[model samples]
Target: MKDQSNSNNDPIYYQEATTLAKLIRNKEISSVEVVQAHLDRIAEINPRINGVVTLMGEQALKSAALADKAVSSGEELGPLHGVPFSIKDAIDTAGVPTKRGSKIFEDFIPEKDATVVTRMKNAGAIPLMKTNIPEFSAHWESDNLVTGRSLNPWNPDRTPGGSSGGESAVIAAGLSPIGLGSDVAISLRGPAAFTGISALKATHGRVPYTGHFPQALSRFWHIGPMARTVRDVALGYSIINGADGIDGYGIFAKDAAPATFRIPGQKIRVGWVSDTAFGPVDPEITTAIKATAKLLADVGCDVAEVRLPFMENTDWLTPYFNLVYGELVPYMQQYTRGRESELHFIGKATMDYPLLNAAEYVKAEATIEKLRMHFAGYFQEYDVLLCPVNPMTATGHGLNEYIVDGKTVSAYHVMTATAPFNMTGLPALSVPVRLSSETLPINIQLVSRWFDEATILALGEKIQTGSEAYGKHPIN
Candidate 1:
């Protein structure tokens, strides 16, 4: 890991996507310039971080040139006009290799873009590159047979949180201004927390999951925006959200147009939790959660420490893992049956996941409904539930277990704070609040009721305002 504090000297690379759009629209900077700068930054920084796996420099530059031409013609521009953004390899990109972090589909390239990618392109954001991920996106660390592992930008020895780790690492290092990432359990929030960036996993169906790899786990899957700033995340989410008429889950997505900016008229009610359900939270992380509650209260919001009994008593993880592995294990077996030796550590471990019987699976589904009702009941009283994104800060790469708060905990325990939201299909946003004693970032997960992204995003913006993590890049 090179300690190039001046690696992020170029202001263009660090500017938010929202700012880049304005700069390009106002002719202060050309789209080509911005695109080229990001591509150059990727060239310089990607080798050390291994975040971006495939580059589209030539295609991106051509697209940028066309964008510049469109500007010259004074044509109508979209909200993200002339901005460059990245896509996770698990998502399809037309004519670009989306390897999905697996050797099986290493050469696979989709002829059509995913719904989210199409929406972003239509909004005038150019696809820059594909980021790394855990093989089949089934692991906690972003290592795979196809692209190896994505290292944390904060410290190369540590692992960036999995699946969307590459997206978080690049955004945190200023290689890309904004990007798209998918979340199953903690893919979006955990990585964003690990890298000191902001990510939004909107209500499950708020964004379509069409064309994403391993389509088996679509029930718990969500695709959303990841960026360094809340405003940029809001901008990206606004463009990519809503039913696309393709995904089954998308068809039932509630209309967010009316409530896009609807902040609660009353004093915002915030409930903070630290150690009730989420096991073995770091002491520094608990302090940060309390500090965040104070921050909310100081801002005149009705903030209090509260616990959800359902969370404490019920086993959310069993049902979540049952559903996840129920679909994913079989899907993975088809590809790894004959060539298991080619599998990466995470990929091989995924194969060992136990599959539930029909009765057990049906029971798991019922439990999910029960959990949803529990959250719905709680939300009727409180507008937001704030908690730690992960029990510990970013950990060193390739560890199967972690010692958090002096207790040895399984690697899957980190997902304790994040998986419940995925099961309930609620809107959750990860915002960096403070740094740990080791200078690692500590993020607070703000979850809102179904289709109530506005509440969490509004709260995220307020939390972001006081965050030292904002505008501070790890590479710098």
Candidate 2:
């Protein structure tokens, strides 16, 4: 396998994506060279991480050459001019296979680019490769029959987090400085936290999701930026957010950005809650999150232990799942019913949700509405809230089920902190917080009010500095 060291010996690999974009603008380095560095990194490490499944190296180089021509000709530069990025397999790319990490669509190449993909290209970001994901982008883990499981770059023995697992793994390993990830609830944020990358889920409807498969029908799905640093995420967000002809949601404004990616100075109101209106957290994860809250307190942030009354029971979680997974049955029955051999086990699991009777649907929606209101009230006073992304860090892949703390759990129990946000449509992020006992990366989640994603990234940056995931390179 080729190595990154040959191509990426300079400090450019460590620079923020935005910083590299400027270097391209100034003609200090050509986009072609940058693309080569990323391709080399992917070759050297991707076999182990399994992050990128479909490489567009030739296409990327072609794009980079064109970018060089533009610069040499003194053309006006786009916001992300000459930067390289990848996409979760779930997002479509013109003439490229977007398998959504399923065997069923391994041969499926799209005739058109997803809305965000088109936008990124227009902004001059070179398309690098297609990252991996679970089948149909259903489960939280990045394992499917087609591409296999994505291992954490930090430790091969652990998982990288999913369905944006490939996106997270690639960024954490320093392959591509930034990439796109879709999150119905926690896909973008969860994997970021697990892999120790920086990411932003963005406000609901901030970025268009028009060519994203499966979540195409999802009202709550969001396609946003995932990168190694908060500033990189912001730069990507600027490039990707825009109205698409097919999307009902209007394009996001280019003007909005937080003053800083990391919070600065005087104590801001911060709230900490280990348990939630969802499932229980793993003791290790819980302790790590609480410790982070305390760390922030030491940094002079006004930290308080807060609670959301609605999270005290599980009555709402079942329906929330039913509404999401329940809706999938119809799509699969139409798309995959006669084609079972084309699907993975989790795709079958997703199809099983609609089997729930109308009684189940009624119950799920009723509880979801109440839970949404209950949590909305909590945002009245807090600037941001912190919690565990999942009860546990990345675990072994391919288990049909898990035995969490000795109790038999459903396949979906691990996504405890994630799905509830889908129910409420509130923006949240899983910020890498601290190292665990095994020396793996563990993350704390931050949830902000509707349209308040700026605060989430700002606070996440502060935590990143303290955790040391900010400057530490996985390949180093």
Candidate 3:
């Protein structure tokens, strides 16, 4: 750990938070310098990234003062002692504006921190600011009227990926060391892939979703950590985990698998995805997949091209969309019925959901059940399923539709990999592995059984071990 004589010397912000915590614990630095350095970093980089919209400079400084006092007086320090952290705008922070990336409620401030936020604070993580998100937390794009769009630090014209896009933006840009992001589907992973950062969407119910947006209000969403490294992801999860006691869909936390965290005798069997699964991905993305497969195989993993129905049931896409649109109908209607001046045009798309007839709902339910059964059959053979979190790096910003190499498609098309897992309630992760041809970060990863996040993350940790530049610097 660096001493206070040069506590804030690290040019890389990703290392700042953990280093700050270590310094404070070892009396090499005070909490105040750590907090101020982060605040200063936010002021420096956030303008370009827009990752942090609402700054808590004053509150963060105050918290740092208290934490240092405690440290000096020999009081106990939590796991995240005096480390500064940012919350995705979708998550509540007491008295802080969490606009959920829409103009309709841009000024909405909550009276209490979301349960996840509260738990993180209880661990002594300093509240630096709230990051950005997409409107109503819909779509994978993180931009909304509230804070505009969070641009990719790698290339400003490209998007950072959505929903949790802002969180990825900040971490990738080195604006904040770590932040919270809720993933309904590929929200976290999309940006993680595009930004080349570490993130994990824990099994639903393992992480509480209380006090967040409509996505968190429902059962099909999860809140997880976005960080520059796997250890950081594990640290963030270790803090905010367990039941928050408010979300009705949130069950009590489960016991940890084992202290050793090593599958002593079992060979890692990962079903790899080659060129054709869940729609065509960019060749760059596929190249990363093949490279990863080779690495795993070289490392003694039983890696082979095993196709497990990722795109076997394209006929069911409409039904899945119906289920999604149905679940989001109320929120869509609320914004749609809202005054045009009060809402963004995207929210208007959601407004028409109420008009769907009874037949549509019935068909959607049947399709979902069948899809779930089909996916369950795939898991019977493979312990883990490797795939893309997104097909390419972050796409162009502000374009409702995407045109990939002369092929036009809906903006939502990129999210195919993630949504299917959510549809089946399977646990998935998007681990940052390598950068794309454009030098944008690519997240290469896999999914496991419903409650088997440990296996997915275990493999992610292994893959991350081979990536030297994955978290080199969000800032040039």
RMSD of model 1, in Å? 2.7
Candidate ordering by TM-score (highest first):
1, 3, 2
- Which candidate tops lDDT? 1
Candidate whose TM-score is highest = 1
Q: What lDDT does each candidate get?
A: 0.87, 0.77, 0.75
Tens-place lDDT per residue, model 3, 1-476, is: 11111125445355745665787888887778777877777888788878877889899899999999888899988878888888888888889898877777788999988988888888888888888887787767776676787888878788888878888888877677788988776877788888878788877788888888885237778888888777678778877777767777667575544222225686767778844665557777777788888888887887779765547547455667666777786655655464666665556565554545789788777777776787677766667778888866788876767765456767777877778777676777788777666677777877876677777776777888786454455565
Report the alpha-carbon TM-score of model 3 versus the true structure: 0.91
List clashing residue pairs in candidate 2: 243-251, 277-311, 282-391, 319-364
Tens-digit per-residue lDDT, 345-442, candidate 2: 77877776645788877877788888778766776666677887876666766665666545666656667777777778777876766666766667
For candidate 2, which ten residues in a row score worst on lDDT?
A: 1-10
RMSD in Å for all candidates: 2.7, 4.0, 3.8
- TM-scores for all candidates: the values are 0.95, 0.89, 0.91
Candidate 1 segments whose C-alpha is farther than 4 A from its true place: 1-10, 252-254, 257-265
Model 3: how far residue 437 lies from native, Å:
1.8
